[model samples]
Structure formats: C-alpha cells, structure tokens
Target: MPRAKRKRASSENSTEPAAKAGDKEVEKTVTSGAITPKNKSAQKTGEPEEYAHWLLKSEPESRMDKGIDMKFGIEDLKSQPNQTACWDGVRNYQARNFMRKMKTGQKAFFYHSNCKEPGVAGVVEIVKEAYTDHTQFDPKNPHYDSSSSRDNPRWFMVDVQFVRMLNRFIPLAELKQIHLKHKASGGPLKNMALFTRARLSVQPLTQEEFDFIVSLEDVKA
Candidate 1:
C-alpha cells in the first residue's frame, strides 16, 4: 500500500472518531462538499447515482513503506494491470467516509501531492466502490491499525481505473491564484474543497468546480 504524506494535523495512525480528535470543522466542511446535486436527484427519484466529481492525491516522490517504495503517480496508475489499482491506505475518518460515498463509474482527478510542481495530472474512474482496506489488517503495513478487525474494518478503499492525462498539467501555484481570485468574486471555485481542505488527501469537487478546472487545460496561464 502506498503511504500518503501526513499533511493531516493529527497522527495518521489515530483511529479515534473525527469528533473526538477535534476534526468537527473539517468533517462538517467535507460532508457539505461531498453532497453532490446528482446524489440528491437520485434520492428524489429513488435511483442509484454517482458523485459528481472528486480529487485524489498521491505522492510522486519515493517514500519507503515497510521496505516497499510508496511513490505512486498518475503514470504509475496507468501502468497497473488493467490500468486499475486499489486506492488504499487512507487513514483519515473524513477521507475514508468520502471514499465510502463514492459509487462505481464516478470520475476523479488524480492530483500529485508532496512533490515538486504538485497539481492535477490526470483523471481516473472508480471501478469499484468502497470496501475494506486490507492494509489495515496487515501488521507489516505502514497503515496497519491494530484497533481494526476483519469483522469490523476501520478503513476502506476504492479501485480506480486510469482515464487519461489532462491536456495540460494544472500546477498548484496557478490553482492558488485562481482560488484567491474566485473567492473575492463569488466564482465557482471559491469554496472548492481542494483549497479549503488542503491537507485532505481525498476531497470532493462540485460539478461546477470540476468543469471550471477542466476548462483551464485549454487556457493559457
């Protein structure tokens, strides 16, 4: 399992509930952001549906995890068997819950984090929805949680299939400028989870924000 950078303020290994760990603010923000209009429509119609969009982060630089290299980028995902891999090792309760909300066939931006020029590099589709994360049960796994059990797993993961790289790599620096600009003018990305919850490895994106960001690929910075 790839080891995600501990950009989170709390210890990644902590299994306490988000409320107990003083994460109510983050949980509240993520909960609101994760609620896509599509989901509401599905609920109103009594039909199954997927989230509008999401963003997943992984470190591109080498980081050892129990003697295994933990570096995983968009290209690494593209080379996997069937160009798919389990998005495991997420320990944050807020992030884990977001994964659980994902439905198959949903799309997500593959963002490079903890690396030089970190930014959204590509897209991926959720091939499999939430399931128990096996790494949490393995003693040798860096993400192992002795508190979790097979019967009542504490972590979950989804399987994502590579879609395609963005036409242009959107750098984080450029995104920050856009975020700041939009925040002042009531633009689409003003409340984007990517900027509001910078430390979260997995974040939700409203349909408008997703589309707006994708449109940037063709625009000159």
Candidate 2:
C-alpha cells in the first residue's frame, strides 16, 4: 500500500498535550494530509489497491443457543446463512484491537476451530463497526468479567454477515499451501495474521488473497 502523505505543521501551533501510558505531557508532532501517489506515472504499475479482509474464529457450538444441537447451531448461524451478526465474545485485547480496526463491508473468513474439522468454512462481511460487546456486561455470561465496568469496559466486538460456505473445507494444510503460494507471489498473505501465534482469531485478509481462496472452491469441484 502507498504511504499517506505527510505535511509539516507550523511550530507556533504544533505543540499539544498528549497522553502516554497514563501520563499527560506536551508533545510536538507534525500533521500530515492524507497521502497517496500524486502521479499515476510514478505509482507502481501493477499493484492492486488495498482492501481489508479479516478472519473470525469461533467454536460454533459455544455460539449456539443452549439445548440446540447441530454441527453448528442454527440460532448461532447468520440469519440469512449469508447475513451478518455482531461477532461478540472476544475477551483478549489484541483481538479487540483487530475488531476495532475493521470497517463496515470488510470481508472475513469464518474459521470453525476446536471442532471436528477446523478450517476456513465460509466467508462473511463486516456489517457494523466496533462497539462495546454487551455480553461482557452480563454477569451471568461466561465472558462476563468483574474488571469490565460500564464506564471503562475492556472488550469490544464488530458485526459480521455470512457470505457462503466453501464447497469443501479449506483445510489447515490447504491454507498453508495457499499461504506459501501467496508469499511466493508477493502478496499480503506473506504477513497474514493466521501465521502469527498471538493472533488466532479475527485476522485481516487482503482482497487478492480473498479472491484466491474463494476461487479454489470452483476448480473442478
């Protein structure tokens, strides 16, 4: 992706009080205007524009209503089977950060984990931006926490709508092959969140990689 343009700020008005790790201090920083390639001739000749993609991990059974049984519960399922749902239940800070970064319309890979066949099973679209995850406030909920107060909640979630299930499971091993191929082709999968141990759920995907993965379901199936 092209770096955003930066602009210099006048010294007289540049200083401002900034918060750092719980302390306030005066810091001088430059203000930059939105940056992008100024001239097409100077831009990379064959680069696709950046579009965000995400992978959302869920233990399908946990998400379903109690007493309902299925490979995955219907109540937990996206209403249209292609509709979006607020991806609540995340308790980790890093996962919350990724959710906060996601914008509406961003794509997500729905990965079913801790199940019989853990893999990318379907596609979803971000339908809502990050918001306080209400489940965290419910004292009876398993995700509830004494540390998370209404005034200073520590958890967040975003809405994701279902797209379509892959015709066949995109197995973990298959994803590895796709990841390697993407790396060789100089794509975003080279630095994918799925490859990072700390980020097992709610990951970003590039548009190119999204198309590539979906295409696999159509080949000679």
Candidate 3:
C-alpha cells in the first residue's frame, strides 16, 4: 500500500494539496513536451485520454534534495523527506518552457543526477502552478542574473511536491535491462526519452512509460 503522507501548511514552505475548486483549476496544459492539453484533458475525461509525462533532474550532491542538507548549517532534512522545494536554477529555454507549462496534478519522474546510481528515484506532482523563478533576481545566488527584471523575468519555475520515495534505487542498469529485453522481442525501446537524450534536463514521459515505471516493485524485505 502507498503510505499516507501528511500535507503541511503552505506558509511553512511545505507542499499543499491541489485546490479542487472548479473555478481555480487552470486547464491542464503542456506547452513544451509533445503532449498537449487537449489530449490530456480528454484522457482525464472518459474520452480515450493520453498520459502526459515529464522527467526532472536534481543533483543529489547539491542542496536540491532536502533529505541531505545537514552540512548547510542546518539540521538533517531526513525527517521531512517530502518537503516541497522551489525548482529554480534552470537556464535553458527548453527547460524553462517545461517548467512554465507544467500544470497542477501533472506527474513527474524525479531523477537524481551527479549521483553514483543516477536514475529515476521517485515520483512527484505539480501541486502548484508555474511562477516567476525568484533565483534569477537574487544577485548573491549563483543562479542570479542582472538581466532579469521583475516585470520581465527571464526564467520560470514550478513547485514539485514529493509523493513517495521508492524503497530501492531504480538504477540506470535496470532501465538498460528492460531495454535489452524489449529489443530482443522486436519491441520498441524508444519510449524512454531519458535514454535517448541524456542532457535534455527537461523532457516528457508518455503514459506508457509512466505506467511501466510505477509497476516496478520496491522489493522491500
């Protein structure tokens, strides 16, 4: 069974649940990836809906993951593993569009880069809509820039709320295993965009890819 996670108040800088209000819900949209809002909405409804998928990269060595932030003159973030952090620092235009296009409830694959066993680590959701990336305005921050004004922001970002952490690492080796097996049967292994384009930083996953990923058991003892 999936563990029940506690939703924290937004004021505490935690990820709040999606607003279910009909008026507030923005139309589901995907501006960058191949998936389109119209198709995704149809999928949401009874009309043969297609799944919209995306891949997000985070460096475990960096302060991106709240779980490993003890060395930053702060307490261990292990207790609050599901804390939602602002995903900023994206400079690429394609990446920024993906961030801007992300809609609430969109599923994302959290991949840990710059790590020994870099691969899909867990799942996350776009709980909040895209907004201006604040880091671009901060001069002290490495991601800061003098060109981006408040009125004309150069970057954008989305809020990702942690869903659940897989018990075991979904190693890249395992993904390769699946590919080889599929290829042997004359099946297409092209579903995984991550494998084809290593430096995309931001990419979409198809519904088929999303289902195959979730189907992997954690293999807990």
Candidate 4:
C-alpha cells in the first residue's frame, strides 16, 4: 500500500440557485463538452431524461483546502446522506475520465475551488452514474488506490442530487472578468473548460457554458 501522489480534490463552492427540478429539458452532451441535441420539441419528452452539463469542485474547507480529509463543500453537499453524495476521492485520470462521462440526470455546477472566495456554489443533479470508488479499496483510505483491483478498478464515483442552494456566491474573480470578455465568443465560452482545467475536478460545460454560468445566478437573484 504505497503509491500515493493523488491529492487534488476540494476545489471550492459558495451556493444559491435552487429551484429547477423537473420538466426534463433533455440535454446530454459530453466527450469533452459536446452537447447540442435539444430541439425536436425538447427531444420528445426529454429522450428518457437524458442530461449533461457539469463542473464539480468542492472545498468549503476540507482540512484548510487540501491539507487532508473533509472533501465536500456546498455546505457539505447540503448535509449529505440523502441530499446524496459519493463523488468520491477522485484519483485523477483526467478527473476519472470525467467521472466516466456522467449520465444519470446530468447537470452540475458546484464549483468552489481552494477557498476564501472562489466561484459558483450551486446546482447538482447526476443522481448516480459511475461507481466502484470503494474509497479506492480502503487501507484506511485517503483514497487508498494501491494500484486498484477487484478486477481492475482504478477509481470512480458519481451520485449528486442537492439541486439548489445558491443565495449569491459566483466569484472566481467574477468568472475571470467574464473570461476576459468572452475570449472571442465562437459560440460562447470560447474554450472555457473552467479556465483551462484549473486542476480539473470533473469539468465540462457547454450548454452555452452551462447557460452562461447559470446566468450569473439569475442576474444576481
């Protein structure tokens, strides 16, 4: 049990927008932010609840932002247990292949990197998708993954729900000044993988950059 160099979770979160829950607007796109199908009358009843849109980073504190343990923000995923949780100790492999291309109910944007005043602090859905993150085969897990195996598992987890908690917290220096004034908007978000994968904790958003960062919490609520 040795090989450990994976320690980059707890990104950041603040929390406010929380009302959208149903009426499936059926949108699902990944393979690195590629989602377009949403017309045919909202995909004829949301094509079996297909969904896609993500950005997950947590760290309301997390042992002073990565000193160790804690690993959950947005008010600990709205006091988990049932608000749902298990975006386990990711052992990055491009953020575990973007959580194996999540696809339960899609929609995510709970950013909150490092601490103090990061950005985005709301939205979540992916109600269970990938699995097998048994704390990387716990040997007193700090995401123990001594070369994972139970027949070759490396690390994975997905199961978010807590939809809505925003009250006002979008910061990341005001979305990097709106990503330097729409860095040449070629369809918006001009290559915004959360500012070039800032430590990539499962990022991928392009429903027009997740509706322009959830429409800045609805024009600041």
Cα TM-score per model: 0.80, 0.65, 0.65, 0.33
Q: Going through the candidates in order, what is the number of backbone clashes in each?
A: 0, 8, 2, 13
Decoy 3 TM-score against native: 0.65
The true-versus-predicted C-alpha distance at residue 210 of model 1, in Å, is: 0.6
**Pairwise lDDT winner, candidates 1 and 4:** 1
Better of 3 and 4 by lDDT: 4
Q: Estimate the overall C-alpha local distance difference test score of candidate 2.
A: 0.54
Model 3 C-alpha lDDT per residue in residues 1-221, reported as the tens digit of each score: 11112211101001111122111113233244433456655357332233356777655543432332211100111233454655656665645655766778998877665445566777778777678777679775555668789999877777676776766667667777786776667444444656654545566676777777767745532
Choose the strongest candidate by TM-score.
1
Ranking by lDDT: 1, 4, 3, 2
* Model 4 CA lDDT for position 102: 85
- Residue-level lDDT for 99 in candidate 4: 74
* Candidate 3, poorest ten consecutive residues by summed lDDT: 7-16
Hey, what RMSD does candidate 1 come out at?
Answer: 6.4
Which pairs in model 2 have colliding backbones?
A: 4-35, 5-35, 7-32, 53-205, 83-161, 83-162, 84-160, 84-161
lDDT of 2 by residue, 1-221 (tens): 11111100000101111112111111111011111366342154332233387777665443233332222322255543345455666655545555777778777787766455556788777777888777678775555667788998767777666667778767666776666887788664665556643233555566766777778777652
Highest-lDDT candidate:
1
- In candidate 3, the residue pairs with backbone N, CA or C atoms under 3 Å apart (3 or more residues apart, or in different chains) clash, namely 43-49, 53-205
Ten residues in sequence with the least summed lDDT for candidate 4: 18-27
Off by over 4 Å in 4: 1-53, 60-98, 102-110, 113-135, 143-149, 152-154, 157-204, 210-221
